[model samples]
Target: MIALLLALGSSLAYGCADFLGGLGARKAHVLRTVLVAAPASLAVELLLWPVLGASFSPSAAGWGVASGAASAAAFALLYQTLAIGPMNVLSPVAALVSAVLPVTVGLLQGEHLGTAGLLGLPLALVAVVLVSAGHGAGGARPSRTALLLAFGAGAAIALQLVFLHQTPPGSGVAPLIVGRAVSSAVTLTAAALLRRRLGPEKPVYAVSAAAGVLDSVANLLFLLAVRSGDLTVVAVITALYPAGTVLLARGVLAERIHRGQVVGLGTAAVAVSLLALT
Candidate 1:
């Protein structure tokens, strides 16, 4: 239950990060947004590193770098999709792909939580899809490109969870630091390759930085959750970040909440409860 709560908190933080990152991307180049976000995220982790007494590990570092690069690509593609697609289409597809992969991986790794957690998995899955559903009551469709990018982002995100959890507990902070550093470099290169430029917008940098920091912190919390709890449950719960994002959009962006979202939220709550009891 503790681990589940931690995962839930991580989801909320990640949702905030995604929202802020998207806001920042609107004002700056995608790569630029990542570059700033990466370092800011690194700094936050570093602050916690000493207190947490996290040691270093080359293997962990390698995983972090790989995960970071994947994340960078995911972010870039997600922003590009957002620029040309609808939220209803992009968000759900991405969230579903991301959650499914890790859940599959967790099962493959011999992790099990009995019937309750098992049942919760499908509910969590449904929640992510429904929560990400757009404004249309019947069937609002988004651009195919948006759907594709969202899937890509979701896949990348799932890979990230797999890699992060595969790291040994008590591994040092080196993995996160290396991941951020490599991500920054890779994102910058991508920006150059794509001919995207950093603009002179302050809000872009500020929001991107905030997003990065929050995401980094959330990642750290996720690692801690895994260290202390069942990876299967943790992954399922953490992957529910779309719930937080949708709520924020409704509250801050005044985005209309559709029936699908309400259903999704209720499903997620039930899943969390079942997972907890199990």
Candidate 2:
């Protein structure tokens, strides 16, 4: 239950981070947004590193870097998709895919939970899809390109999560440091390859930087959760991040809430209770 709460908290933080990152993307190039977010996360992690007094193994750090590489691609694509609009379509695709992969892997590995957690799992997944559903104006058919990018981002996100849990126990925040460093490098190279300029509206810097901090923190929470809880539960719970993101937009931007999302929200609430009963 403690791990589950941590994962849910991570989801909220990640939702806020994605919202801020999307806001930044609107004012800057996608790669520029990534460059800003990654390093800010790295800097914050570094400050926490010494406090943790953690040491690392080459193998663990390697896994961290591998996770970072995949997440860099995931984040870049996610930002690009957000910048293009119609998050209604792409967000669900990414969210569901990210959750499903880990759940499937856990099931295959013979992982199980209390009966309540089991019952809640599929409901949680269903809620994730509904929560991401957009209505009316944003509900227009997504372009083929957007669908493709979202698919890639989801896959990368799943791979990143898989590798993240592989880091040795008791490594503290070491994996986070390595992952952030690797992701920063990957994002910079990708930016250069695409010829995306770092120079953008100065105001975007603060937003992107804040996004980085939130995102990095979320990653730490996720790793902690994975270390303490079942991967299937953690992944599925965290994947509900879109719920917070959408709620934020509704409150801040006054975006219309889809009926499906309202249902999803209620369903998610029930599912959490069920999981907790375990």
Candidate 3:
């Protein structure tokens, strides 16, 4: 139950972060937005290090670096895919793949689920897809390139979570700190390389920074949740983040919530209840 709550918190944080990040990206280049966000994320992890305590064991460091690289890849690929999107299809495809990969890995690693969990997991996956379904007027279908990038992004996201889960329990928040550092460096490097292409539009610094903070919080929560819960359950629950994003878009942006998303929100609630009962 505790793990379920933590995972849900992670989902909420992730959703909010994505919303803010998207807003920031609209004002500036994606890489420019990331320039502000990545360092802010690293700063949050650094602050947490003192409170949470950390041990930079070699295993932790290695896994942290791996997760960091995966995170950078995920960020870049996902943004590019969205830029080239038929978003309604690509978003759900990425979300579903991210959830499915982690769940599969968890099961392969010997995690077992109760019957309720088994049922809930599939429902949760479906909910992720539904919640991510965009209500935008029809656009051109995504190119094959966009589809491939979406798949790559999803796989990278899955790897990030899986790698984080591989860290030793005693490592504290060291892995996160290390991962954030690496990711920050990668983001900066990419920004530098693309500076010429980045337009003159000023970034929404405050929004981007807030997004970073929330993203850090989300990662911290996910790390804690996975340490205490079955990875399969935690991953599926976290993947339901799109529901939170949809709700925020409705409440904050006054965007219309589509019928599928409304149904998805209900399905997600039921799925969570079933998982909690296990």
Best by lDDT: 3
lDDT of 2 by residue, 1-278 (tens): 88899999999999999889878877877677777788899888889888864568897788888998898788777767755657778888888999899888777778888899989999999998998777734547778898888888888898888888888887878888988888888877777877745564543888899999999889989988988988899888899998888899999889888899999999999888887776
lDDT of 1 by residue, 1-278 (tens): 77888899888999898788777767765566777888898898788777776656777877887877777777667667666667666777788888888878877888877888879888988888888777742365666666777788788888777787877677756667776777778776776776634555544677888999899878887877877787778877887887787788889889888887899899999999999887
Off by over 4 Å in 2: 79-86, 136-148, 196-200
Q: What are the lDDT figures for the candidates, one per model?
A: 0.78, 0.84, 0.91
TM-score of 3: 0.97
TM-scores, all candidates, are: 0.89, 0.91, 0.97
* Residue 74 CA displacement from its true place in model 2, Å: 0.9
Model 2 TM-score is: 0.91
Q: Write candidate 3's Cα lDDT for 188-260 as tens digits.
A: 8888888899999988999999999999999999999999998899998999888778888889999999899
Q: Which ten residues in a row have the lowest lDDT in candidate 1?
A: 194-203
> Which residues of candidate 3, in runs, are more than 4 Å off?
137-140
**Model 1 alpha-carbon drift over 4 Å, by segment:** 84-86, 136-148, 193-202
